[model samples]
Target: MTTKITWLGHSAFQVETAGKTILLDPFFTGNPAATVSADSVAADAILITHGHGDHIGDTVDIAKRTGALVVANFEIVTWLQGQGLENVHAMHIGGSHAFDFGTVKLTIAHHGSALPDNSYGGNPAGIILKTADGNIYFAGDTALFSDMQLIGDEDLEVAVLPIGDNFTMGPDDSVKATNFLSPRIVIPQHYNTWPLINQDTAAWETNINLQTSATPVVLQVGEHFDLS
Candidate 1:
């Protein structure tokens, strides 16, 4: 089967594989780079990497309307439930779970977790998806970490990383991360949203292309990359 990975701008993504539509950090409401409205998309599950307002964007509204299962850290899941979202699965870092779509493992990420409502969100995480097509690593808003080499053991087909500097790793660090993960394909994210986090993605892509064995796939918002 073919797996489709769509960049929704910022760090938001839509992954379709094995008859399931999984959304990661589905922020859209206030996102200037958003391509789709929150309620307009269909999903089987929603994956949250952290509780930040941008990352958790329209989870409450989308989940309630579509009845999609929301997956996140314990605190974020609890907070979502309190917001009247009934279907939720709470998973923490270093834990892996299997759903109908595929398998998911949450990896460590160097970032903070504070919900929009001031709730105590748990640790931020990078999510790994193992599917029939291949493995995809979604490195949520994070800084460069050495443990990414450990994550490379999964034999990943693609890796999604942040290149925005202020809140996450910059171009140089993201290139370092690409070398550490060493996936077949690497995609850049979490940049160009605003001036503070702005980045020259083409330059970053060029740097990665020269420094790493991985192919740097710089996607415009809503563009799709398929692994068949």
Candidate 2:
């Protein structure tokens, strides 16, 4: 099966592979960058990277409506259960789980995990997906770290990173991250959602071409690319 990844704006992504539709950080409710509505998207599974409002956008509504399995850290899982969600699976950093769709391994993410209500969200995480088509790494809101070289050891087909400066790493650091992750394709996100986090993706793509070996693919909101 082919793996298709769609940028749902910001750090949100829709991954379709192995007959499953998985959503990562599906924040569409108030996202200015989102072209689709939270009411329209379909999912078999939802993965949350942190408890940030943006990252947790519309997850409850979407998951409840679609009966999709929700994967997240313990704290976020507890929070979801508190909000009356029953189809949640909790995992933490360094933990890996196999699902009907693929295998997901959570890696360390240097960021906060406070929920929308300021509840403890648990440790933030980056996700590594091993699928039939290829491997993928989704580096949720994070700063550049050296351990990404170890992540690169997975032979990633693509790496999705945040490039917004105020909340996450800016473009320059994202370029450096690509150098570490060394994926065949690198995609940028978590930027241009608002004026505070706005960035010029074109310039960042140029820098990625010059400084890194990965091909930079800057997808527009609602655009998608195939893997394998």
Candidate 3:
């Protein structure tokens, strides 16, 4: 079975695999290239890395409309429940949970997770998705850390990382991350939405190719790639 990966701009993505559909950080509403509106996106499950507005964008509306199970840290889950989203599974870092589609392991990430209301948002985490085809690592808004070598030991097929700087790793550090993670393919995200995080993705891809063995995949907003 092949897993289809689609980039919906910013940090949002759709992963289709094993007869299930999963959405990650659905921030499509205000995005210029967002093809589907918040109320129209559907998924069997949704994984949130943190509680930032850009990452949790439209999650409340999307969860209400699709009835997808929301997965994230304990605090975020509790917050979502407080917002009337009942179907949520709260898992802490280093915990793994089995779902209908696959197993999701919460990995470490260096970022803040406070909600806009100034409430404790929960521990930020990256998601490691183990599917039938291969392992996918979504490094949700992080800085370059040495532990990525341990993640690389898992033999990941694809790694979705942020190269947007300011909020996450910049292009140079992302290149280092690619070398440490050593995934077969690397997809850059969390850039170009606003001026604060704007980046030249094409140049970043070239720099990564030169600095690491991993192949860099640059996806336009709403573009999909099939990974078998």
Candidate 4:
């Protein structure tokens, strides 16, 4: 089996695997670094990592347009339901749910969760995808935490981590995180979207390469990585 992962800028990603199209943190409309528009995105399911405006970008509109199921925490699910959205799967940290293509486990993350409208967004989380081809870890907006070692048990094939500071883990902490998850390949996200979080990806890559065995795959806005 083969899986294709595309970076959509600012932590957003398009994962095509197991005959399903999955979108992670589909922020785009107002994303300064986004390469595609909200109208151009289509997916079988949408997975939201948190309730921040940047992470939940265009989720309601896109779900309404494509009828794609929205997967999120209970609080965020209820918020979306109030918006007249019916297709949603409410999940929580440490819980795993089975989908048509694979399993999605909501993992722990250190961050805030508040909807754009000031409603409760539940707890922030990272996503662990157990797919046919490999396991993928998408670390949403978060600071470095110790439990990441648990994710290593899955034998992570790829780990998509936020390298932007101020709001999330910067290069130093992110490198330490790699020591925990130990994925075969690591991809940097959530950087360069804003000046406050802007980073030198090349420096990050070099640091990781020197310190860890995992290869850092730095991608552009629309770049992709194909794995088996």
Candidate 5:
């Protein structure tokens, strides 16, 4: 079966595969483009890249309401557990864990993960999801790093990366990242959220097309795509 991915604005996304639905960085409750609130969204699994409010937004409420498994680093999992979230799966960078949907490998990310209350949230991470169809990478907030080539050396079909600067890599660096990762398809995220990270995504895609062989796929908020 093919995997379907939906962009929910900012760093939020919905990925469906093997009859299971997974959510990534679900920060849609107060998101300007948010179509549904945390209480309305349902997921079989929820993956968090870090513990920042924007990244971990509404996870506790959503997990409590939907009984979804919250997956993240050990500390974040512990914190969520303290919040009374029963189903929490903790994994560290370079570790792989098997779930009902598939296996997920936590890759390294150069970023911070302090919780809203300023508690340690564990090391930030990028997620590499291996499903029945193909492998996918979600490069949570990070800067340009050469190790991306090593991480992308799998059967990668799609990669979701941040092209928003100030908090992440800019368009130029993201183009280089695409060249290094060389995924079949690339989607830009974490941009146009606010003035600090605002960017011309179309322009970024055009630049990436000239710099890499990977096809850039820019999706509108609430838009969905099926990976072949």
Candidate 6:
């Protein structure tokens, strides 16, 4: 089995594996850099890392249209429920659940989460996807932390991290994260969508390759990469 990972610009990604297509942080409706529109996105499941507007973009609209199961933290689930969405799974950090395609585990992420309506969004989280192809870690909007070494124990094939500064870890700290996780491949995201987070992925890749054993895979918006 192979996992096809698609970068939808910024932190949004479309992952296809085991006959299922999952959307992570599907923020595209208002995304200036999004290549695909919300109406065209098809998802078996929608995984959310936080409740920020940019991260939670079009979740309710997409779920309503596609009936995709919305997997998120308690607060997000509750908020979605209030919006009359019945297909929702409420899980918190350190929780894992199995679906038709594979298993998903929510990990710790250092960030704030307030819903679009300004309600508490619970603890932010990262996502670990275990599939037939390999284990993938989506470190959604996180800073560099020492426990990343622990996440490396899963024998990760790919680690998708944020290299944009201001709101998330800069290239320097993200380079440190790559060394700690030491995954076979690393992809940088969450940058260049806005002026505040504009970054040079080429320069960041150079830093990562020089400092860590992992190879950096940089993708253009709307590009797809397959995992071996």
lDDT of each: 0.93, 0.94, 0.91, 0.93, 0.90, 0.92
Residue 95's lDDT within candidate 1 is: 96
lDDT of the structure predicted as candidate 5: 0.90
- lDDT of candidate model 2 versus the reference: 0.94
Q: What is the lDDT of residue 128 in candidate 6?
A: 94
Q: Please list all clashing residue pairs in model 2, or write none if there are none.
A: none
Off by over 4 Å in 1: none
Q: Over the stretch 143-192, how does candidate 4's per-residue lDDT look in tens digits?
A: 99998888888899999999999999999999999999999999999999
Alpha carbon deviation, residue 149, candidate 2 (Å): 1.3
For residue 151, model 6's alpha carbon misses the true position, in angstroms, by 1.0
True lDDT of residue 213, candidate 3: 92
Clashes in predicted model 3 = 0
Q: Which stretches of candidate 2 lie over 4 Å from their true place?
A: none
Task: Kindly list the per-residue Cα lDDT of model 1 for residues 92-194, writing each as its tens digit.
Answer: 9999999999998999999999999787898999999999999999999999999999999999999999998989999999999999998999999999998
User: lDDT tens string, model 5, 1-228?
Assistant: 789999988999999998999999999867776776797787999999999988899899988888899999999999999899989899999999888898999999988999989999999999999988888999999998999999879768998999998988889999998988989999999998877888988899889888899999999998988985
Using TM-score as the yardstick, the better of models 2 and 5 is: 2
Off by over 4 Å in 6: none
**Candidate 3 vs candidate 4: which has greater lDDT?**
4
| Shift of residue 128 alpha carbon in model 4, Å | 0.3
Question: Candidate 3 has what TM-score?
Answer: 0.97
Model 3, span 30-115: residue lDDT tens = 77657788887878899999998888888888899889999999999999999999999999999998899999999999999988
User: For candidate 4, what is the lDDT?
Assistant: 0.93
Candidate 1, residue 91: Cα displacement in angstroms equals 0.8
